[model samples]
Target: MRLLQVVESAATGVGRHVMDLSGGLLERGDEVVLAYADWRMDRMFAEGLARLEPKGLKAIKLPFSREIGPEDLRSIRALRDLIRTHGPFDAVHGHSSKGGAVARVAARTVPRRLYTPHAYITMAPTIGVRKFRLYRALERYLARLGTGTVCVSHHEKAHAVGTLGIPAPTVHVVHNGVAGPARGDRESIRAELGVQEGDVAFGFVGRLWTQKNPLLAVDAFARLRAVHPEARLLMVGTGDLEDAIRARGVPGVELLGERNGPQTMHAFDAFVLPSDYEGFPYVTLEAMATGVPVISTETGAIGEAVRDGVDGFLVPPGDATALSGAMARLMADPALRARMGASARERAGSFTIDGMVEKIRTLYAG
Candidate 1:
């Protein structure tokens, strides 16, 4: 099959998703062309890009800004031309809102044109009502141009159908998956984080934004510090609330800016995410893959991924007390953590990159 994957705002996990999906497709002997927006690409990504050249992966830069601007017109035209040049693509899959819109409109005649809104803007409570209404209306308006809207989680699919008013028949849920991580050097990773072997280290990864609620993580960790003075919390990733979180001077809290997810997982005894919302958190999944027990809010399809108390614990979103308790529960019981971590690794097997791509491949054929 000849496939074209369109990704807008491929700066974060969405970019990684495209890379994983495209790489999987290429390995399966599919001819794949990726046209992605330029947002954030680091040194590691540069090396990945170069490696992809020899693997028969075709990538094109078709930058799309976050806003609805004049550049969108050019992007649409470029997409249409690219489709014409790479004629008769078996499928054209668009990722995220902007990419979904442009791909559907530009290549409306494609036999199988699928769109995946990683997270719909309307799903965000922080987005004002008026803006949410406008985005919802836009999504509904664009549904006619695409063959299907792919959702990464059941929660996202429900929102698309119930809240966004997209036709139920038009939405397909394909949970995102990751390649299994190679075990990292535990001694070296812990040394880097200044977390000694005997001390329990709770870790959080993702931006310091309101949506992520890093402040909640800070407060929760602070609560645990009173009881478990040796408990260390490693907060990875920086964002808007970085300064505010730092100002609190939360005891035993260490702010380690963004690091490679798989590599740093070895430093954590347990993982915590008090995110207010999530489409489907790749961080939690990555943590689970590393055999780390998780304490996360029941957001998105997290409950589907994490078996509360079995693999780890799930608290209500924004409940610092509950989050802290869960963290402390893991810290207090090493045997429990060990049991949960092993269960987490077993549970994570079902969400592998091979499974996700195979599910998607079946969809393409159908």
Candidate 2:
């Protein structure tokens, strides 16, 4: 089957999804073309494309911004032309809002025009009521253009069908999957993060944006520090909240900006993500794949991944006190940490890239 995968902000999790899906399709002898925005491309994603290009992957840079703008008109036309040049794909899959909108409108000729809202904007708690209503309305209309909306999680699917008022039959759920952790020297990774063998290192990896709630992670880490002064927090990735996070001058917190997330997972004893909202982030699954327990907010389909009190603890979003308490629990009990980490790895086995890709491939055929 011939296919086209389109993405605008292909820098983080969404990029990983497209890369894994497209690469899997290619491996199965399917002709795949990836349409991406070079302006928003990161080194990691560019490198991903490089690996696949040699494997018969065709990539076209059709620049598009993250937000809605006048440039979108040009993006839609470019997408239409892409479909023409790569004539008659079996499917055209779009990732995220912008890419989803453009692909749905432009790929009207395609038999399967699928859109995956990695996370709908309306699902954000921080979004004001007016913005929420506006996005909901726009999404409801745009969703109809696609043959189906593939949500990355059940929670996201609920928002699409229930909140956005999209037809239930047209909205589908397909959980994101990981290829397990990258093998690396654990000792070397820990040493790079300044984490000693005795130190309990809590790691956070994601853009330091409002949705990720990096400040909440720092606040929780600070509280844990009062009890365990020797504990360290290793934060990877940079974003809008970088300055704000650094401004607090939180001690024992190493801001190691923008590193390979899976490779860096070896440095962590426990992973922490206090995101206020999510659509099942890959970093969380990568941490589990590395056999590290997680302490994340009960948002998105996180509960579906991390079994609270079994594999890890899930506290309410934005609760520093609860977050800190969970971190403290893991720090004090080495036996518990080991037990939970083992459970995490065992649970993570169910969500594999092979399984996810196979399901999506079936979706394309359906």
Candidate 3:
């Protein structure tokens, strides 16, 4: 099968998903091509690509922009030309908003196409009501053109059908997957981070965006400090809100920005994400895979991944008190955290890269 994955920015979760899915497809004897817009501003893209390219995958750079303008039309035309040159791909899977628009438009001249909105633009709190409605209308228009829409979470599928008025039948939920950690020397990582053997290390991993609500996590940690003074917070990944998160002045918070591979999973005792919204964050899955008890907001499909009081705890979105309480519970009880962490690892095993790849292959074949 000839598959083309179109994505705007090769930066975060969506970029990583494109690389992982494409690489998995190739490993399964499918020919895959990943075409993404250049991310000149994001150093992480260059760094991530350095690791991804060596995995026997082909990546194409294309011009793409978030704003719809004259240059964007030119980009669409250029994308059309790329599709024409690499004609009749078995499937064209699109990721992100700009990529979805370009791919769906280009697919009109092609055969089969699928779009996976990593997180719909309309769902972003930063988008105004008028613009959000307009984006939803546009997405509805695009949904009519594609073969099918793949949502990362059930909550996302619900929004696609309920909020955006997309037909329920057209949407499919395939949660993000991650490879389990390689049984890293956690004590060694803790030692390097100057954390003692008995100190509980709380971690959060993701971009420092408003939607991630890193500041809320800081506030939650601040509350947790009262109960468990020795608890430390380790944050992974960088974003525009880095300074703001740092400015929160929360004690024992270590910001280890932009780590990839094994280092990403190591140096954590538990994982917490207080995202305001999401389309099934990969960080939560990755954390669970690393045997870390997760405490996250009930954003998008995260609730499906975590069984509250079983694998992890789920607080309401933007509820600092609830988040802080959950963290405190885990921090104060080592046995409970360990049991929940083990269950989280077991839950994550069901969402392996091979399982996700096979599901996509089946979808493509269907």
Cα lDDT listed for each candidate = 0.86, 0.89, 0.82
Error in Å for residue 315 of model 3:
1.0
Better of 2 and 3 by lDDT: 2
lDDT of 1 by residue, 36-117 (tens): 7667565544565677869999988886777898999999999999999887798899888889899988987678889889
Per-residue lDDT of candidate 3, residues 47-159 (tens digit): 65676577755677888877877777877787788778875688888888888888888778656778899878777767898998888889999998998888888888888
Candidate with maximal TM-score:
1
Query: What lDDT score goes with residue 44 in model 1?
Result: 45
Off by over 4 Å in 3: 40-56, 245-248, 260-264
Best by lDDT: 2
Colliding residue pairs in candidate 1: none
Predictions: Cα RMSD each:
1.5, 1.7, 2.2
Error of 3 at 304 (Å): 1.3
Rate residue 12 of model 1 by lDDT: 71
